[model samples]
Target: MKKAVFLDRDGVINEVLSSRVKFVNKPSQFYLLEGVGEAISLLNLAHIPTFIVTNQGGVGLGFMKESALHNVHKKMIAELAKYGAHIEDIAYCPHKPTAGCVCRKPEAQMLIDLASAHNIDLSGSIMVGDREPDIEAGKKAGCKTVLIGDESDNFAQANIVFPHLLAAVPWILEELH
Candidate 1:
Protein backbone atom coordinates (compact mmCIF):
# COMPACT_ATOMS: atom_id res chain seq x y z
CA MET A 1 0.00 0.00 0.00
CA LYS A 2 1.13 3.57 -0.67
CA LYS A 3 1.87 6.08 2.05
CA ALA A 4 0.45 9.58 1.92
CA VAL A 5 0.39 12.82 3.88
CA PHE A 6 -2.79 14.73 4.52
CA LEU A 7 -2.49 18.46 5.23
CA ASP A 8 -4.91 21.07 6.45
CA ARG A 9 -5.10 24.03 4.11
CA ASP A 10 -5.51 27.27 6.06
CA GLY A 11 -2.94 27.48 8.80
CA VAL A 12 -0.84 24.52 7.71
CA ILE A 13 -0.27 25.59 4.12
CA ASN A 14 -0.83 29.32 4.28
CA GLU A 15 -0.67 32.19 6.69
CA VAL A 16 -3.69 32.52 8.93
CA LEU A 17 -5.14 35.84 10.00
CA SER A 18 -5.63 35.26 13.68
CA SER A 19 -7.61 38.42 14.17
CA ARG A 20 -10.29 37.41 11.71
CA VAL A 21 -10.58 33.80 12.79
CA LYS A 22 -11.23 32.85 9.19
CA PHE A 23 -9.59 31.46 6.10
CA VAL A 24 -8.03 33.27 3.19
CA ASN A 25 -11.17 33.94 1.25
CA LYS A 26 -9.48 35.46 -1.77
CA PRO A 27 -6.40 34.80 -3.85
CA SER A 28 -5.17 38.24 -2.88
CA GLN A 29 -5.39 37.28 0.79
CA PHE A 30 -3.56 33.98 0.26
CA TYR A 31 0.09 33.83 1.05
CA LEU A 32 2.21 30.72 1.42
CA LEU A 33 3.85 30.52 4.79
CA GLU A 34 7.66 30.63 4.87
CA GLY A 35 9.39 27.33 4.04
CA VAL A 36 6.14 25.62 3.08
CA GLY A 37 7.07 25.29 -0.58
CA GLU A 38 10.50 23.87 0.18
CA ALA A 39 9.03 21.50 2.72
CA ILE A 40 6.47 20.18 0.27
CA SER A 41 9.21 19.89 -2.32
CA LEU A 42 11.14 17.66 0.04
CA LEU A 43 8.12 15.38 0.37
CA ASN A 44 7.80 15.28 -3.40
CA LEU A 45 11.42 14.27 -3.76
CA ALA A 46 10.81 11.50 -1.25
CA HIS A 47 7.92 10.21 -3.39
CA ILE A 48 5.22 10.69 -0.79
CA PRO A 49 1.87 11.77 -2.10
CA THR A 50 0.44 14.82 -0.34
CA PHE A 51 -3.19 15.78 -0.23
CA ILE A 52 -5.05 18.77 1.24
CA VAL A 53 -8.09 17.97 3.35
CA THR A 54 -9.78 21.09 4.64
CA ASN A 55 -13.03 22.39 6.04
CA GLN A 56 -14.13 25.34 3.91
CA GLY A 57 -16.92 26.57 6.13
CA GLY A 58 -16.61 29.99 4.59
CA VAL A 59 -18.62 28.71 1.67
CA GLY A 60 -21.49 27.50 3.76
CA LEU A 61 -21.53 30.67 5.81
CA GLY A 62 -21.65 32.75 2.63
CA PHE A 63 -18.43 34.48 3.43
CA MET A 64 -17.15 33.55 -0.01
CA LYS A 65 -18.32 31.74 -3.10
CA GLU A 66 -17.00 28.33 -4.03
CA SER A 67 -15.60 29.80 -7.24
CA ALA A 68 -13.50 32.21 -5.20
CA LEU A 69 -12.15 29.35 -3.18
CA HIS A 70 -11.27 27.48 -6.35
CA ASN A 71 -9.42 30.51 -7.61
CA VAL A 72 -7.42 30.67 -4.41
CA HIS A 73 -6.55 26.99 -4.67
CA LYS A 74 -5.51 27.44 -8.27
CA LYS A 75 -3.15 30.18 -7.29
CA MET A 76 -1.81 28.14 -4.41
CA ILE A 77 -1.13 25.15 -6.65
CA ALA A 78 0.52 27.30 -9.25
CA GLU A 79 2.74 28.90 -6.65
CA LEU A 80 3.76 25.51 -5.28
CA ALA A 81 4.51 24.24 -8.76
CA LYS A 82 7.00 27.06 -9.16
CA TYR A 83 8.92 25.42 -6.30
CA GLY A 84 8.54 21.98 -7.88
CA ALA A 85 6.07 20.84 -5.23
CA HIS A 86 2.78 19.20 -6.12
CA ILE A 87 -0.42 18.38 -4.30
CA GLU A 88 -2.00 15.03 -5.23
CA ASP A 89 -5.54 16.17 -4.60
CA ILE A 90 -7.62 18.52 -2.48
CA ALA A 91 -10.71 17.39 -0.53
CA TYR A 92 -12.77 20.04 1.20
CA CYS A 93 -16.05 20.15 3.07
CA PRO A 94 -18.07 23.16 2.11
CA HIS A 95 -20.48 22.91 4.99
CA LYS A 96 -21.04 24.97 8.10
CA PRO A 97 -19.50 23.64 11.29
CA THR A 98 -22.99 23.13 12.68
CA ALA A 99 -24.10 21.21 9.62
CA GLY A 100 -22.83 17.97 11.15
CA CYS A 101 -21.31 16.98 7.86
CA VAL A 102 -19.44 13.70 7.60
CA CYS A 103 -16.61 15.17 5.52
CA ARG A 104 -15.34 17.89 7.84
CA LYS A 105 -12.20 17.79 9.89
CA PRO A 106 -12.52 15.82 13.17
CA GLU A 107 -14.44 13.39 11.00
CA ALA A 108 -12.48 10.81 9.01
CA GLN A 109 -14.79 10.62 6.04
CA MET A 110 -12.64 12.67 3.70
CA LEU A 111 -9.44 10.92 4.69
CA ILE A 112 -11.07 7.51 4.47
CA ASP A 113 -12.42 8.35 1.04
CA LEU A 114 -9.03 9.54 -0.11
CA ALA A 115 -7.34 6.46 1.31
CA SER A 116 -9.77 4.17 -0.43
CA ALA A 117 -9.44 5.97 -3.76
CA HIS A 118 -5.65 6.15 -3.59
CA ASN A 119 -4.94 2.80 -1.92
CA ILE A 120 -3.19 4.42 1.00
CA ASP A 121 -1.90 2.64 4.08
CA LEU A 122 -3.29 4.74 6.90
CA SER A 123 -0.95 3.16 9.41
CA GLY A 124 2.04 4.51 7.51
CA SER A 125 0.46 7.81 6.64
CA ILE A 126 0.54 11.16 8.42
CA MET A 127 -1.76 14.11 8.85
CA VAL A 128 -0.31 17.55 9.50
CA GLY A 129 -2.33 20.54 10.59
CA ASP A 130 -2.47 23.45 13.00
CA ARG A 131 -5.66 22.49 14.77
CA GLU A 132 -7.09 19.80 16.99
CA PRO A 133 -9.67 18.77 14.42
CA ASP A 134 -6.88 17.82 12.07
CA ILE A 135 -5.29 15.57 14.67
CA GLU A 136 -8.63 14.14 15.59
CA ALA A 137 -9.36 13.20 12.00
CA GLY A 138 -5.96 11.64 11.58
CA LYS A 139 -6.42 9.56 14.68
CA LYS A 140 -9.86 8.52 13.55
CA ALA A 141 -8.41 7.44 10.23
CA GLY A 142 -5.57 5.55 11.95
CA CYS A 143 -2.84 7.86 10.63
CA LYS A 144 -0.13 9.43 12.73
CA THR A 145 -0.71 13.12 13.44
CA VAL A 146 1.59 16.10 13.30
CA LEU A 147 0.40 19.39 14.71
CA ILE A 148 1.96 22.52 13.25
CA GLY A 149 1.78 25.58 15.47
CA ASP A 150 2.89 26.88 18.83
CA GLU A 151 -0.49 26.70 20.49
CA SER A 152 -0.20 24.93 23.81
CA ASP A 153 -3.73 23.63 23.79
CA ASN A 154 -3.40 21.99 20.37
CA PHE A 155 -0.24 20.11 21.29
CA ALA A 156 -1.79 17.41 23.44
CA GLN A 157 -3.52 15.49 20.69
CA ALA A 158 -0.80 15.24 18.07
CA ASN A 159 1.68 12.40 17.97
CA ILE A 160 4.31 14.99 17.03
CA VAL A 161 4.08 18.73 17.31
CA PHE A 162 6.22 21.25 15.48
CA PRO A 163 6.28 25.00 14.98
CA HIS A 164 5.56 24.74 11.29
CA LEU A 165 5.20 22.40 8.36
CA LEU A 166 8.89 22.67 7.43
CA ALA A 167 9.93 21.77 10.95
CA ALA A 168 7.71 18.67 10.85
CA VAL A 169 9.13 17.26 7.60
CA PRO A 170 12.34 15.86 9.08
CA TRP A 171 10.44 13.77 11.60
CA ILE A 172 8.20 12.42 8.88
CA LEU A 173 11.17 11.58 6.70
CA GLU A 174 12.85 9.84 9.59
CA GLU A 175 9.75 7.79 10.25
CA LEU A 176 9.64 6.71 6.59
CA HIS A 177 13.23 5.59 6.81
Candidate 2:
Protein backbone atom coordinates (compact mmCIF):
# COMPACT_ATOMS: atom_id res chain seq x y z
CA MET A 1 0.00 0.00 0.00
CA LYS A 2 1.16 3.54 -0.76
CA LYS A 3 1.73 6.11 1.92
CA ALA A 4 0.36 9.64 1.64
CA VAL A 5 0.27 12.90 3.52
CA PHE A 6 -3.03 14.70 4.06
CA LEU A 7 -3.01 18.44 4.61
CA ASP A 8 -5.58 21.01 5.61
CA ARG A 9 -5.79 23.90 3.18
CA ASP A 10 -6.36 27.19 4.95
CA GLY A 11 -3.87 27.51 7.75
CA VAL A 12 -1.67 24.60 6.80
CA ILE A 13 -0.97 25.53 3.20
CA ASN A 14 -1.67 29.23 3.18
CA GLU A 15 -1.50 32.19 5.44
CA VAL A 16 -4.67 32.61 7.45
CA LEU A 17 -5.91 36.20 7.53
CA SER A 18 -7.33 36.04 10.99
CA SER A 19 -7.20 39.78 11.28
CA ARG A 20 -9.56 40.17 8.35
CA VAL A 21 -11.66 37.05 8.75
CA LYS A 22 -11.44 33.35 9.34
CA PHE A 23 -12.22 32.30 5.77
CA VAL A 24 -10.50 33.14 2.54
CA ASN A 25 -13.34 34.05 0.18
CA LYS A 26 -11.44 35.15 -2.87
CA PRO A 27 -8.48 34.20 -4.98
CA SER A 28 -6.77 37.47 -4.10
CA GLN A 29 -7.00 36.57 -0.47
CA PHE A 30 -5.26 33.24 -0.91
CA TYR A 31 -1.56 33.42 -0.30
CA LEU A 32 0.87 30.57 0.20
CA LEU A 33 2.88 30.73 3.36
CA GLU A 34 6.64 30.95 3.11
CA GLY A 35 8.46 27.61 2.58
CA VAL A 36 5.19 25.78 1.85
CA GLY A 37 6.07 25.21 -1.79
CA GLU A 38 9.54 24.01 -0.90
CA ALA A 39 8.21 21.63 1.72
CA ILE A 40 5.76 20.17 -0.76
CA SER A 41 8.56 19.83 -3.27
CA LEU A 42 10.53 17.83 -0.77
CA LEU A 43 7.55 15.57 -0.16
CA ASN A 44 7.15 15.08 -3.90
CA LEU A 45 10.85 14.23 -4.21
CA ALA A 46 10.37 11.62 -1.48
CA HIS A 47 7.60 10.03 -3.56
CA ILE A 48 4.86 10.77 -1.06
CA PRO A 49 1.65 11.92 -2.66
CA THR A 50 0.03 14.92 -0.99
CA PHE A 51 -3.69 15.47 -0.74
CA ILE A 52 -5.58 18.48 0.52
CA VAL A 53 -8.71 17.95 2.59
CA THR A 54 -10.50 21.07 3.68
CA ASN A 55 -13.82 22.40 4.91
CA GLN A 56 -14.93 25.38 2.84
CA GLY A 57 -17.94 26.40 4.87
CA GLY A 58 -17.77 29.80 3.20
CA VAL A 59 -19.54 28.27 0.20
CA GLY A 60 -22.47 26.95 2.18
CA LEU A 61 -22.81 30.20 4.10
CA GLY A 62 -22.94 32.16 0.84
CA PHE A 63 -19.78 34.03 1.65
CA MET A 64 -18.35 32.95 -1.69
CA LYS A 65 -19.33 31.03 -4.77
CA GLU A 66 -17.94 27.63 -5.54
CA SER A 67 -16.41 29.03 -8.72
CA ALA A 68 -14.46 31.54 -6.68
CA LEU A 69 -13.14 28.75 -4.50
CA HIS A 70 -12.08 26.84 -7.58
CA ASN A 71 -10.25 29.88 -8.85
CA VAL A 72 -8.43 30.16 -5.58
CA HIS A 73 -7.41 26.54 -5.73
CA LYS A 74 -6.21 26.97 -9.28
CA LYS A 75 -4.01 29.83 -8.22
CA MET A 76 -2.58 27.85 -5.35
CA ILE A 77 -1.88 24.85 -7.56
CA ALA A 78 -0.20 26.96 -10.19
CA GLU A 79 1.95 28.64 -7.61
CA LEU A 80 3.03 25.30 -6.18
CA ALA A 81 3.76 23.98 -9.66
CA LYS A 82 6.19 26.84 -10.14
CA TYR A 83 8.16 25.34 -7.29
CA GLY A 84 8.09 21.88 -8.85
CA ALA A 85 5.53 20.66 -6.36
CA HIS A 86 2.16 19.11 -7.02
CA ILE A 87 -0.74 17.94 -4.98
CA GLU A 88 -2.30 14.65 -6.05
CA ASP A 89 -5.88 15.71 -5.28
CA ILE A 90 -8.00 18.05 -3.28
CA ALA A 91 -11.13 17.05 -1.32
CA TYR A 92 -13.28 19.71 0.23
CA CYS A 93 -16.47 19.82 2.25
CA PRO A 94 -18.58 22.70 1.00
CA HIS A 95 -21.25 22.42 3.65
CA LYS A 96 -21.97 24.59 6.63
CA PRO A 97 -20.57 23.50 9.96
CA THR A 98 -24.11 22.83 11.19
CA ALA A 99 -25.00 20.76 8.14
CA GLY A 100 -23.88 17.59 9.91
CA CYS A 101 -21.91 16.50 6.86
CA VAL A 102 -19.70 13.48 7.29
CA CYS A 103 -17.12 14.86 4.85
CA ARG A 104 -16.05 17.73 7.07
CA LYS A 105 -13.02 17.77 9.31
CA PRO A 106 -13.34 15.66 12.45
CA GLU A 107 -15.50 13.22 10.45
CA ALA A 108 -12.83 11.40 8.38
CA GLN A 109 -15.16 10.66 5.44
CA MET A 110 -12.99 12.55 2.99
CA LEU A 111 -9.79 10.88 4.17
CA ILE A 112 -11.42 7.48 4.13
CA ASP A 113 -12.67 8.10 0.61
CA LEU A 114 -9.24 9.22 -0.54
CA ALA A 115 -7.59 6.20 1.06
CA SER A 116 -9.96 3.89 -0.77
CA ALA A 117 -9.55 5.68 -4.08
CA HIS A 118 -5.76 5.82 -3.92
CA ASN A 119 -5.03 2.53 -2.17
CA ILE A 120 -3.29 4.36 0.68
CA ASP A 121 -2.15 2.78 3.92
CA LEU A 122 -3.73 4.84 6.65
CA SER A 123 -1.44 3.40 9.31
CA GLY A 124 1.62 4.75 7.52
CA SER A 125 0.05 8.03 6.50
CA ILE A 126 0.10 11.37 8.25
CA MET A 127 -2.30 14.28 8.48
CA VAL A 128 -0.99 17.79 9.12
CA GLY A 129 -3.15 20.75 10.05
CA ASP A 130 -3.46 23.72 12.36
CA ARG A 131 -6.68 22.87 14.10
CA GLU A 132 -8.13 20.39 16.52
CA PRO A 133 -10.66 19.09 14.03
CA ASP A 134 -7.85 18.19 11.66
CA ILE A 135 -6.21 15.99 14.27
CA GLU A 136 -9.54 14.41 15.10
CA ALA A 137 -10.21 13.56 11.47
CA GLY A 138 -6.77 12.04 11.03
CA LYS A 139 -7.20 9.96 14.15
CA LYS A 140 -10.59 8.77 13.01
CA ALA A 141 -9.00 7.69 9.73
CA GLY A 142 -6.26 5.82 11.67
CA CYS A 143 -3.51 8.23 10.54
CA LYS A 144 -0.78 9.70 12.68
CA THR A 145 -1.52 13.39 13.23
CA VAL A 146 0.75 16.45 13.14
CA LEU A 147 -0.58 19.68 14.52
CA ILE A 148 0.84 22.96 13.25
CA GLY A 149 0.75 26.27 15.08
CA ASP A 150 1.33 27.42 18.63
CA GLU A 151 1.89 24.86 21.32
CA SER A 152 -1.05 24.45 23.60
CA ASP A 153 -2.96 21.96 25.65
CA ASN A 154 -5.62 21.85 22.94
CA PHE A 155 -3.19 20.03 20.67
CA ALA A 156 -2.21 17.39 23.18
CA GLN A 157 -3.91 14.74 21.10
CA ALA A 158 -1.56 15.26 18.16
CA ASN A 159 1.24 12.74 17.69
CA ILE A 160 3.58 15.61 16.88
CA VAL A 161 3.35 19.39 16.93
CA PHE A 162 5.22 22.04 15.01
CA PRO A 163 5.10 25.77 14.33
CA HIS A 164 4.45 25.30 10.63
CA LEU A 165 4.16 22.80 7.79
CA LEU A 166 7.79 23.20 6.76
CA ALA A 167 8.98 22.08 10.16
CA ALA A 168 6.65 19.11 10.20
CA VAL A 169 7.82 17.60 6.92
CA PRO A 170 11.24 16.50 8.13
CA TRP A 171 9.73 14.82 11.15
CA ILE A 172 7.14 13.11 8.98
CA LEU A 173 9.79 11.86 6.56
CA GLU A 174 11.87 10.56 9.45
CA GLU A 175 8.87 8.81 10.97
CA LEU A 176 8.12 7.13 7.65
CA HIS A 177 11.58 5.59 7.70
Clashes of each: 0, 0
Give per-residue CA lDDT, model 1, range 1-177, as digits (tens).
999999999998988876544568999888888899999999999999899999999999999999999999999999899899999999999999899989998999999999999999998999998888999999999999999976585754788789989999999988765
Reference-based TM-score, model 1: 0.95
What are the lDDT scores of the predictions, listed in order? 0.90, 0.91
Per-residue error (Å), model 2, residue 37: 0.3
User: Pairing residues by index, what is the TM-score of model 2?
Assistant: 0.95
- Candidate 2 per-residue C-alpha lDDT over 47-147 given as tens digits, one digit per residue, 9 for 90 to 100: 99899999999999999999999999999999899899999999999999899989998999999999999999998999998899999999999999999
Task: Please give the range of 10 consecutive residues that has the lowest summed lDDT in model 2.
Answer: 15-24
Q: Candidate 1 local accuracy as lDDT?
A: 0.90
Off by over 4 Å in 1: 18-22
